[model samples]
Every structure is written in C-alpha cells, then in structure tokens.
Target: MKDVYLFSGFLGSGKTSMLTNVIKQLKERNLKPAVIMNELGKLPFDSQTVEEDIPLKEMLEGCICCSGSEKTEAQIQTLLLNEDFDVLIIETTGAAHPVEALDAVYSPLFADQLNIKGIVTVADSKLWLERESLTPQVRSLFLEQIRHAHLLLANKMDLLSESEQAKVIFEMQGINSHAFILQTTNGQVSYKLLENLQATSRISKDDIHSAKIGKHLHLSSLLIEFNKSYTQQQIEDWIKTLPSTVYRIKGYIPVEGVKNPMLFQYAYGLVQWLPEYIKMPAKVVLIGENVDEVKVIDE
Candidate 1:
C-alpha cells in the first residue's frame, strides 16, 4: 500500500515551501513522491512550484473538503493507476478544514490501496498570536486545522523574537497537546520525522460525520486581471486601502518597466513581491470574506 500524507495550513502559512523541502528530501532518500495540490482559485499558481519529474495533480476552483471531493477522488485514482510512486502527498487549500478534507480522501473506492499517514499542519507563528483579531468563523477554522494535526509545524519562527516564539509555542501546545510540534523557519522539517508520523487516533469517519462540517464560512475569492501595467507603489497603496476582512491575495502582477510580471502575496496585512523570470498571467486572486463584492481595482 502506498503511504499518503496530507499537508494542512492557512493561507501564506508556508505549506508550499514545506512541500518543496519534503519533496527534495524524499527524492534524496530514493523514494518516489507524487503530489495533489488544491487551490481555491482557477489558476494553479502553487502547482507550478512542483518539479516536472514528479507526478502531480491539481484540484482547483474549490476546497477539497466540499465541492472538490469527487474530483479529488478521481485525481487520486488516476495517479494510483498511472504513476509509480512510493508516497502520495496532498496539499490542501488553506481554507480547507482538516477533518473534512480527510473525510474526502477516505473514499471506499480505493481505501485499501493506500495507507493514510496523517496531517502535517503548518501554523504561522505571527498569525496564531493575532488570531483574536480575525472574524469568529475564520478563527474557528484556523484553530480546527491545528486541533486535528498529528504533526504541527510552528512556522516562520524567524520572524518572531525569542519571547514571542516561546509564547507561540506555548499557545500551540496548549491547543493541541498530542501533536508533535516543531519550531521551523520557512517550513523546514526533517523528512525522517514526517516518514515516521502516525495518523492521529482521534480522526475517524464517525467523528467527521457527527460533526457535519461543511463549507459554511462566508469566505469567497475574487480574481483580478490587470489590463495595463501599474507601478509597484500604486498596487501597494491599493492593498493598504483594503479592509481587514481580506485574508490572502496572491498571483502575478504586471509591474511597470519590468519584463516579467512579479509574484505578489499579501496575507494578514503583510505584502511580499518576488521577481519572476518567466512571464505569467497578469492576474491576482483575492481570498477573504465577502471578497467578491469588494472592488479590486480603483477606477
């Protein structure tokens, strides 16, 4: 049976970075790895991060826990039938609830063919500290992800001071005492640690059914396509004008005077722009509560 591992985290929690590291380590150990990446947007921005050699599948435009369950099953079946890999890694959308996502993977069609390892949840140290500021529904989803994790990563430790790190660790441990917690920078963790992890005994189909968790959160996404190039300052100024309800914004933006569009990521008021050599679509996907109603570009 092939081993299956799930990666769960909120937006901008460094899941893709962790997935990249895990894939590199797995390859070094002579183990073939396959990936299933879920994205809330139509464009597969994160899927591009996976290497070409690895067998990869993408489920887009929905969260795996809700609208994409059937599609996820089909993708898994396709990989199992055509790919030769020792392990399968599923990176769920940040908005996905862990238990529901797990339920989606437990399809009877191929349950016996795979060994479900567990979930590795990445928690942003700074976000955990300021979770109280989030809307109640969003905060609940954030905590639920950690609560169901078997191995939790307290990521972005480098951004915090020593005392802040201690506090974040304490809070995370307090919430999920059973999970093996690690302080990490850029989502780095030992592959051996991941290989040895066991699924949390608390996660069962019965619990998931009893909870009846659904995609009830008011969160929505908006895709913004740029018609013309804009200065970096103009984009940054517009981002600053956004309300706190916006959780994440990511995609490529056409920057004035730049040959290629830059990758932009904004999460919880923090903004980052990375230069990309290859030109990508000049579009951005904004994910948040009532995001569809928000005007993305200033007229």
Candidate 2:
C-alpha cells in the first residue's frame, strides 16, 4: 500500500522547508516519494524551491477544503495510476484545514490502494501567541489545524524564551490533548517522526467547511529578481525596511564574499538566513495583503 502523509499548517509555519527535508530522508532510504503542493493562489513560489527531481503535482488556486477537492482527487488518481512511488506527501496551504484535506484523500476510490500514515501540523510559536488578534474565523481555522493533527510541530522555538515555550506547550496540550508535540527550530525535524504513525481523526466532511466562514484572504505575490551580489549588512538593511504587511519573504541571494548563496526567510517579523551551496537564481517572493510592490522593489 502506498503511504500518504499530509502536512497542514498556517502560513509561514515552515511546512515546505520541513517537507523538503522529509523527502530527502525518504530518498536516502530508497523510498520513492512524490509531492503534491496545494497553494491558495495560482502563482506559487514554494513549488519552485522544492527538490528538483521528486515528482511534483501542484494543486493551485484553492485549498483542498472546498474548491480544490475535485482537482486533488484527479491529481491523486493520476499519481496512483501513472506514478511509481511508495509514499506521497500532500503539503496543504497555511489556510487549509486538515480535516478537509483528509476527507479528500479518503475518497472511496483511493481506499484500498493508499494508507494515511499521519497528519502532521506545524504550529508557529510566535503566531500562536498572536492568534487572538486575528479575526474570529481565521483564529478558529488556525486552532482547528492544530486540534486535528496526529503530530504537532511547534516550530520557531529558538525565538521563544523558556517561559514562552512552556506556555505555548501548555496551551497546545490543552487544545490537542492527544497529539505528540515536538519543538523545532527552522523546521528541522527528525525523519523518524514520519514513520509508522496513525491518525485519530473523527472529523466528517460536513464539519470541514468551517474554513469558508471567513472571507477569502486578500493576498498577492511580489517576485523580485536580482542578479547582483549583496553584502551581509545590505541584506539585513533591506529586510528591515520591509513593511509589516508583508508576512512571508523567501528566496536565495548571492553574497559578495560568501561562496554559497544565502537563503533568506522572513515570517512574522522573524528573519533567518542559511547558506546554500546549490545553484539558484537570486530572487525573492513576498506574499501578503496590500503589498507595495514598488516600494518593495525600490528597497
């Protein structure tokens, strides 16, 4: 039976980064793996950043909860019929509800051929504290994602103080009394956590539409392409000028003195960088509401 792993999290929770690492681990074990990335908008940047060789199927313009269900079914059908893979990983958008994605996968047609290995949800420690500031519908959607997970990754733990981490863990346990909560930094998680897992979900398709209660988020993507190398201070200065409205920023940058290209990630006011030796173009994609494209470009 082909194992299916579903990853659900809020925006900028590091789902793509963690999923990429998981795929690498699977490849190391000689396990054929395929990826299905679901994005809320038609223009996607995460798909481009994933591993090049893994078979990837992109489900765009909607989350699997409502509009993407039919497409997801079709995509899964194609993967099962034409692709030779032992495991499949479906990375849902941050706005996605895990229950809906699960219902789409458990369709009658895919019953015998596929097995749900686990439902892993990445929780942003910084964002979790700010959940109360969100609209009622969005806040509820965020909690539902955590409540339904078999494994919850409390990511960005490095930024939290000891007391803050304890409180986040305490609240998470209260919300998801049964889930295995793991703390991680930059989404670096163990591959062994993905093995031999079981999902304890009792959610019905009818309850999954809770995602539609809120208005669709008004979001846009701004792609900035630059071939010139930047100094470390120059990169930091540029990131500091980014507006608060821009929630997510990720891409690669070539540094003047560094041999490897630097990977830049900014989410919820946290800025992180990692040196990547791989060949990649210098560019960044900014996703958020009311993004000032001109100002972002000028910076």
- lDDT on C-alpha atoms for all candidate structures: 0.79, 0.73
Per residue, candidate 1 scores C-alpha lDDT tens digits across 13-87 of 999999999999999999999999999898999999999999999887877875687788899999999999999
At residue 20, give the lDDT of candidate 2. 79
Give candidate 1 regions above 4 Å deviation: 200-299
Model 2 misplacement above 4 A: 200-299
- Give the number of the best model, judged by TM-score: 1
Predicted structure 2, TM vs. truth: 0.66
- Poorest stretch of ten by lDDT in candidate 2: 206-215
State the lDDT of candidate 2 residue by residue for 199-255, as single tens digits. Answer: 311111211122111112223334455556778777677777766766666667678
